[model samples]
Target chain A: MESLVNPYVSVDCVLLGFDGEQLNALVVRQSGNNGEDVAGIYKLPGSLINLDENLDEAAQRVLKQFTGLSQVNMLQFKAFGGPDRLKNPEDSVWLVRFYNLNHHIDRIVTIGYTTLLRIDRKMRKLEGGYEAQWMPISELPRLAFDHSAIVDEALKAVRAKATLDVTLLFDLLPNKFTAAQLRNVMEVVLGITLDVKNFHKKLAQMPYVVPLEEKEDGVNHRAARYYKFKKLKNKHI
Target chain B: MESLVNPYVSVDCVLLGFDGEQLNALVVRQSGNNGEDVAGIYKLPGSLINLDENLDEAAQRVLKQFTGLSQVNMLQFKAFGGPDRLKNPEDSVWLVRFYNLNHHIDRIVTIGYTTLLRIDRKMRKLEGGYEAQWMPISELPRLAFDHSAIVDEALKAVRAKATLDVTLLFDLLPNKFTAAQLRNVMEVVLGITLDVKNFHKKLAQMPYVVPLEEKEDGVNHRAARYYKFKKLKNKHI
Candidate 1:
């Protein structure tokens, strides 16, 4: 054997967007790549790291390409660099196509990152690529590589994190929103019906929920005052 | 390039043991022909999988190697096959160590699985070249490749699971252990002081804990009756 070929590591971003009634996962179209029979089938926003950049930075760059938003929070959840998770040649899993791997083994690697974003059409103008669409979380399409698996893992993480952290809920709610709309979003993400009284009782305990000057308008019932959560950097128990 | 070499997926086990107070990570001294200096230091217990082996089965096989105890509960927390998380002579972090890796990278592709195990010295003793030892979880020595980081990630996972699942706690406790002993182990693993009363209350709610007639003889304070956990398959929730 002459020399072992370096394995490839790519970054995949599983961006989740939550609306008031349902949850959606962000997927992108793969086009103009190494092999491209499949054009616009949805997949997690992903790309190979450029020669000059680091891994986390590479993921951020990929997301920015899709959303035109940079410096958003992200993390590496799992690395899927399987030699054969990509057995089908025509599939996106075929990213494992490494040259000179025959001379020696090439173990392909890709890090999976999950991000929760409050994205609106106002976020960015689409160019060259198709616009990002929010698909129902449960109804995900046949994704490329182990992306379905990645999506599954990201959902588990989101559910676990949402249970303990209200900070993510804050991210989803807008500047001024009705409590009913807020509860609807929370219920959708949590996948359970929460008692209004119990939820209000729990929310009352948190001092961070500052009562805003704003109030709901044109409601059939009595108008409710809108409250905003004061950002707590080091939120401790 | 010829047909791309199929990528292989393997699971590495980072079995952790919490003997009363401090935590220790299980590591094996590998005796193979990859890197010579790696023989003495710690790397996770791992193995390459059979072509037909599913991810979980491969991980279980790797975990049981040290213990000889089959059906040892295990978890695949994260996949860590970074094509170049390995040092390669091609292009890289291993630019200095590149030549060394050029000679190496093809040996194996390892995914890490972290498990909390009941420590038994007999299980740790390997017949051949591999030396299995329980080293302090905090002060683990330099491990082979990124095995050290894999172990750390496993620790985080083991801790997280311990909090959410009672089954993980059973792995830490003795067959018949006092309530205080169980709570102590939980605190050590979690690095938190859980409310003792609430912890026991939750334990009482769990169906698995079978109360034993045994009690600690030497204890000066209130002696708590020992309870052993009934194992369940994937019912950690």
Candidate 2:
């Protein structure tokens, strides 16, 4: 099928995943004009929206095409479309060659979407021409095309939502996760080392977090009690 | 200067204003193809984005042109870019004439921005060719161009933020507002009547809400004490 390029609209995905200990993001390594790998250059998975496609479909296509993952819940956070969003010389070079963006079509506005995943649960592998990696969000390199700012905004959205809704934490943990693992995801996303007493105190108040009968298995340390999020029927909060 | 219209890009504003007793929205009356005023047809303020303009600049221009207001803090919340967004017969008839959209450039994607304002405090008036009104959100008409859905999402964003931050209430109320006025705004926005005892109990716990040594004057009913939001200088929520 011919690519129905609109040149003015695109979608970018910030996939924040967790591996039990740290927060990570799925980023694709952008290559230079010579098809040579550029060291330390990564970007959030993105693509130009097709003329006939919806924005959400475009976002899902970008996620699946880059990370080989599907059926993930994504939330649209913000739109980043400053005129100078592509003024970086390297970004211009990459887009002009790879995306067929000419001078007149360089000022594209991109919609940003975010998703949190349990990377250790699925263990999905990347399978595309673009080399994708799960890099720690804390140690992120300078990204291309205003993506670092996009990631910052996505992180803010995640942190803000995580505070009110315990169900969102389930996206970053296994079916049965330790309280420490849940607290670690919150702390890492909120960028704060929460007090041990205060953290458990807050969790105890949440009726949605149900303690399972089973505990952590086969770990070197003491087995911690596991908990899972229970959806409250007909409750809107 | 020319329009510089990028047919595939546009800006839509969901300007939610509070009018003391109720939450309201600024809506423009959309016209018919023959330059006749379309009865009962309203839309959120919107315009085609200029090719040389940033998304934020485009949104500000649209808001200013429609409402004669500027310098308000606005947030880009979502992007709506369905292929058939403008496929409705009435929407197409209006846009094809006003926007010069042809067959090749019919699918326009719009970035939705939201801003909450104190209508009584500013008293800003609409000054444009199209008639605009501050309609109560509870009695909103069926809006054009997927705007009702956008307004719903904006309300959700405002309500979600309001629960965590008392400072957001200041946008809807005057500097020295009575507790009744404050609770009315919250009740209207959240679409639920908060219990008087429970609401004040929650407010008492919020250190940010400082009770002032003043009372509401020139009212038919009994005078009520006034309060204002006091941000902690070195504290984080």
Candidate 3:
């Protein structure tokens, strides 16, 4: 049987992982000719969707194939279908060689999907027969085929979602975390440096961030209080 | 010259309008055989994107062609690509006749775009040689294809966006709006009845909603104070 993939539509996954310090995005390097250097040609893990799978299924499959992680909650953020998306000769060449296409594919509307993962919790082993790594978002080199713009949009979407859904923040943190840790995650995600005093005041206003009875066990400085995310039935904002 | 349309990808728009009292969505009726009663069948304004235009352009074109509106800010929220999207015989027959397809089109992934409009402000004249009207969201009939789910998702997306960006709410309101009007918009979008006192307290804390030196005139009931939206330099949440 022939492969039943839709060449005009694809899905890309921006798998963001936080390692308690900085945010990183999982990217796969496009292999070059036998020994040629293609270090600068990294792109988001993506593929054209199969005829039988839905979009969400394709996103999940892409995430699993690239990162060797499954069951991660992914959000479909945007669809990128610019006519000039494949205008770059390098990108056109890569697509033809990568997918072994007999004919030229001038356009492909790719749906961008994103998900947040705890880097410390989930152990990542690159799969899908590609050279993949977690590159810190700040240090991401020039990506292939408008992928940098896709990553930028993913970051914006995650920030917008985190603002409305407090539970999303906890996904990047431990089960019980100190105020500073929570603040660190917010600062990284929001791309802003917040004042400690004001952050605590704002955190206090969030009734869902309930304080636990326990405090930090061991630390060089003053031990801080630990809090856990509590989901309220009628929580707004 | 052959048409440069890409049959595998399309754009669907959810044009939501607020009439100060209720929310409505613009839907186009698929005409039936020579004056046949196709009142029960309604679908969102959509079309397969042309190879020359991008996704956003396609969405704008769909909105303009269906409702005679242009330059509307439409946000791409989700992509619907289920294999069974066109499994309905009625939908398949309509698609074949409408697009004049020579071969079977088993799948066409649609990008969902949405925007809010003030029903009383914008004069809508249906175009694109189709019958169209604004249907109350509360009384929407069973839509064709997966549009019902798409509309539901659009509403959820708009509500999520409204919770984060106060400016989006202002789009549905006039330049100067009363407190009740704002609350009513929120109640309809959120699908919740908020307490008047609590809502007032919450509004008071928002620094962006600036009070104007104006009041409603020529009203049967007590005149209400007017307020306007102010974009803050560093607003969060």
The number of the candidate with the highest TM-score is 2
Worst 10 residues of 1 chain A by lDDT: A96-105
Q: Candidate 3: deviation at residue A20, Å?
A: 2.8
Can you write out model 2's per-residue Cα lDDT over A1-237, one digit (the tens) per residue?
Answer: 021223367789999889888899988888755666654588888987876578898888887887667767788988888778878777777765665434545677889999888887344455246677888998998998899999999999888887676567677788888889888887897777888878778888888898889998998999999998887752211
- Please provide, for model 3 over B1-237, each residue's C-alpha lDDT reduced to its tens digit, 9 standing for 90 to 100: 021122378889998988788898988887554534444689998887875788899888888887677887888888998788988878877765666565667788999999988776343544235677888899999999999999999999888877667667767777788889999998998777878988778789878798889999999999889998886553321
* Residue A127 CA displacement from its true place in model 3, Å: 8.7
lDDT for each residue of candidate 1 in A1-237, tens digit (9 for 90 to 100)? 232324445678887776655677787664434444354555677765554455677787888888887877775666665456555444433342322122333334567788776655553334235545667787888876678888888777777777767666666667666667667777876667878877677667877677778887898989998877787773311
Can you give the lDDT of residue A212 in candidate 2?
89
Docking class of 1: incorrect
Displacement of residue A218 (Cα, Å) in model 3 is 9.2
Instruction: Please report the candidate that would top lDDT against the real structure.
Output: 3
The worst-scoring run of ten residues by lDDT in candidate 2 chain B lies at B1-10
lDDT of each: 0.65, 0.77, 0.80
Candidate 3 lDDT (Cα, whole model)?
0.80
Q: What are the models' TM-scores?
A: 0.77, 0.85, 0.83
Alpha carbon deviation, residue A181, candidate 1 (Å): 2.5
